[model samples]
Target: MFRRFALAGFAAALLFLSTTPVVAAGLDAASINDAAAPPTRLPDRQQLSPSIARLEILLDRAHFSPGEIDGKFGENAQKALAAFAEANGLSFDKAVTADLWTRLVAASEGAAVVTYTIVDADVKGPFLNKVPVKMESMKDLPALNYTSPREALAEKFHMSEALLQALNPGQKFDKPGDSIAVANVLDTEKPAPVARIEVDKTRQTLRTFDAAGKLIAFYPATVGSTEKPTPSGTLKVTAINKNPTYHYNPKYKFKGVKSKRPFTIKPGPNNPVGVVWINLSGEGYGIHGTGNPGKISKAESHGCVRLTNWDALRVAAGVAKGTPVAFVESSR
Candidate 1:
């Protein structure tokens, strides 16, 4: 299922919004025709199509992450908008009506993407030569860090390594102080302090809402599995740790570990938990980032909600202490 939501009117809305571009976030203020204003002269579906990339960026700006922006109007984009609509209390009325268009333009306030010069710090890595696949091997590493400059750069931009490569096109990200194109993404305009988090296992998504009950941001998530199911009911957020160390306890007896002694994996971007850990009241269960963003929700988690590192950071930045978290089988 694309989602648990009824798809009855979605086809019409998507068909028109799949092949054109809307006003970009980066266009000159005058040319953009009141980007800060309610949308006027609303764009046709074709115009909305090419805006997929921009839409993805804007949704991301507002913290409704569309995962990796592929510049294609597909499931992720549709889901993103649906999430946005649901958060803002808009009706999915079989089309991208003026209200929705206006809201989107208002949210997406800057250039869809822009150029970034790679800095010394960005390329400077005591980078790992390779990342091991198993916890046993990973425990022995000096740091659970990214294996290369390109990988770091991609994660920094909340992009897929592959997509980043395609954008650069034969340009090696190996050098510091080099210029590269990056999503002129939204700044750290964190949403109003998060009041709660909802993890919809059926759709494999995580959403954050404010005290006003407005959706602040949402992201694709890999919740726990049939074999290692997540805790049911509500859990409170207990703590949040950034660049967390991975502790492999022999007690858990995960498949590949030969050692009975406990060991810790040093912190880095590739750490099993990615960069941030949003610990929940459910013991050993929380929402955290993953080394494999490309596989999010495509795979089951070991009883936690897994988001991309950047997405996790985005989530972490907005939430505060003791927020309520609910794990539910959502109808949508």
Candidate 2:
């Protein structure tokens, strides 16, 4: 139960925003790290707020991912915050209360943003000039690398490409030895082993549990669409494939794919299955990563559950071959 691919349409928009000083000037590390509790009502969708960005980074650090940290208090961010609040016994009524903020900050380690020195690896690319929009065209490419250094660094730190540019105005990501402020979300330590996983279709979320049934991690996810609904009941992990090559089955008859023949897509971050694919017992169904990190939870998948590349990697690292994966149809 996986989509052949979902084209992320935000690249051009992010590239355009990178050049706009006004947009990038609106926030910085100081603003983000020192951000106060947000107002009762969230910021407008169009408005980028440092407070929300801080909130997102904190939530991410706490193992409750907000998907892409775009500095916007959108549904994904709200969902993460609400989940965090519920876990901490704080009542969230669509507001960032002082109690919730205090709890989040206390639970999270390190500042929301920190200085990162760009290394040669960060700037060096075998970078793709452009990724193909169509899945069929993508199969021929050598590798599905990030389109730019900004994209690479942004993904590494679990921040949006636009947010990375916004934090370091006028700083081109092309050079090594340059320093920039980025989200302090590098998970250096290994995650706790997961005994079980729950995919809440209604909530568009994935939650992992420890052997003692304690929540280990939570992530916003893109569930299946009406066209290809996710499987019900429970499944078990069959395998964990890192940097997996995407194999397409013509039998799926995925929309927009004209080829009646099966094909294979090369492995990379932007591959259809992304950095990691946690195979499930159900055929073609597993929780995996997405090329379009920004569109996660906001868009629908073909059938399989989709999380951010980083989150997927973390989840893959945490779960064993036989971990139980339950797909809950509703909140109950």
Candidate 3:
């Protein structure tokens, strides 16, 4: 019976994302318009689509704190669910599924999940214009290899992917032969401060909090390895460097090749450290960007908290000298 329910749930999710012809192929204006046209009233907890409800339950079990699980897909619920999905090698899309629920349950039971929260609103942009741009031709655009075209745009604009998606939700990127609208890009306003960081060692999660204890954002992180346990204590952001030239010292015990070349990689997403570096006042410890976001919170770092390049940049921008950071073992 459980298996049958799971399979049925998965099929329903497919209909939600694929069969919904009105939904666009990428983050585009049409999609956004459709999504914004009439806010579909979310079902009650008992009436929620099985997959979504299962996802909520699993997230709650994993300690993701998906607000009130009345089964309504609210902003808080979506954010929490996305964070959990991202941690488990799933896309951040708010859609839920049986597989996702199963994996989440397994992680909770077996101790494999992690969570992070945004404590501050630091690095602002690439700001997104309320209005989307009309792409005359995607024929000239690059292949859609990554997650969303907006994500690709974020790369082009040198801004956080999360910010791009947040500004333009449910938009489609493909317009076939017609021109598709793209949102106007804006400059980052000002850097703000992150208030708190909640690190769950058991679930291998890290969360950030604001002074008011509100969750601004969240991300998965790679902590220290068993050989080199991550240092515990309250750390503070001492400095932030953008497009930093990494100083690879052979003595530092890095996993990759030891180069005498002092390999100074340029900034951008492909950089070894991604784009931003939050230097912590706690000596050699700091939170920095990573070339591999998919492996975040799942892999081990040298000792510092490792986050996705986009996430790290935002965190760095929000943080400053004396931003307090705490690392704790996760109960979930």
Candidate 4:
């Protein structure tokens, strides 16, 4: 029997908005949208700055995904800015120059952050109380759903859950019709067709190109680890599965999974492979999403190319069977 769970005890019936207006915090929508690029470059250490958060949203809208919008100038955000700079033929290092900032702001759409009203679909979820940490224990669950409405909304806006809460302090995510500030990072139109894909193990990033060799999209990725390295050379895409059942093979001996026997995990947002799977021609290797978006390029993967769930979905939508995917040792 499948156990259904309500998200954060939210009522099935959608609630009307209260008369109270949502107060803006230090990292509020107004601040984010009104923020300007710092005259100097971002600090080397990760810090919560409204400007960085705004920059991240703009990068996300432009398809140079900065893993998750966590209001920090981390390595993932750095990589994304670097990729964006390179695509625009601008010189960049660990810092964002004035020219780069101007180009990014010009390329992006309206505001970086906008007010979004919560809806019934956003709150009404048969969510999971908790996802198991071990792979063996996950097979028995009916489905891997989002743990809370906050998580769903965060992923939907391409923002981190922490950022979501930080932006809306003291507000419970359980009510529909309640206003919340979210990243204006919606990509309504379908992506252009991808001609080729490049997975850089050294850089821990993925890039897609058009038929004319124009860079289409760039994403920070967690490639294979030392335990099981990803394949080299070019490979063709075999298949793309939007909702994939994760079949665990015993031979690979993935650490922390004590099960010697084969098993299959049900598909949902919190599944081992997340929501999408782009299978590669190389045996036992593929590009897929991850349950943990925050640990994207910061963590290690078994042997597959791991992208954020949204990034994986974007890639899956743009690519087709026989799309050339090349794995490189280094971009240098």
Q: Which one wins on TM-score?
A: 2
After superposing candidate 3 on the true structure, give the runs of residues whose Cα lies further than 4 Å from its correct spot: 1-79, 82-192, 260-262
- How much is 143 displaced in model 4, in angstroms? 0.4
**Ten-residue region with minimum lDDT total, candidate 2:** 1-10
lDDT of 4 by residue, 200-308 (tens): 9999999999999999999999999999999999999999998899999999899888898999999999998999999999988999998899999888998999998
Write down the lDDT of every candidate, Cα atoms only: 0.69, 0.84, 0.48, 0.84
Q: Tell me the alpha-carbon RMSD of every candidate.
A: 9.2, 6.5, 14.6, 7.6
Which of 2 and 4 is the better model by TM-score? Answer: 2
* Residue-by-residue lDDT tens digits, candidate 1, 1-332: 00111111101112212332332223321222223321334344323222455566677776778776554444555677778887678975335566776787676555555567778887778888888888778877888878888888877777655445544546688777666655556365444678888999888898888888867778988888876789889999888899899877677655556788998888887888989999998767889998887677778887889998888887788777789999889775
Residue-wise C-alpha lDDT for candidate 2, range 23-117, written one tens digit per residue? 42347777777788877777776666778888888888889899998888888888888888888888987888899988988875667777777
Scored by lDDT, model 1 comes in at 0.69
Displacement of residue 69 (Cα, Å) in model 3 is 22
Q: For every model shown, what is its TM-score relative to the native structure?
A: 0.79, 0.92, 0.49, 0.91
Per-candidate total of colliding backbone pairs: 11, 3, 32, 0
The residue pairs that clash in candidate 2, if any, are 1-284, 1-285, 1-304
Q: Candidates sorted by lDDT, descending order?
A: 4, 2, 1, 3
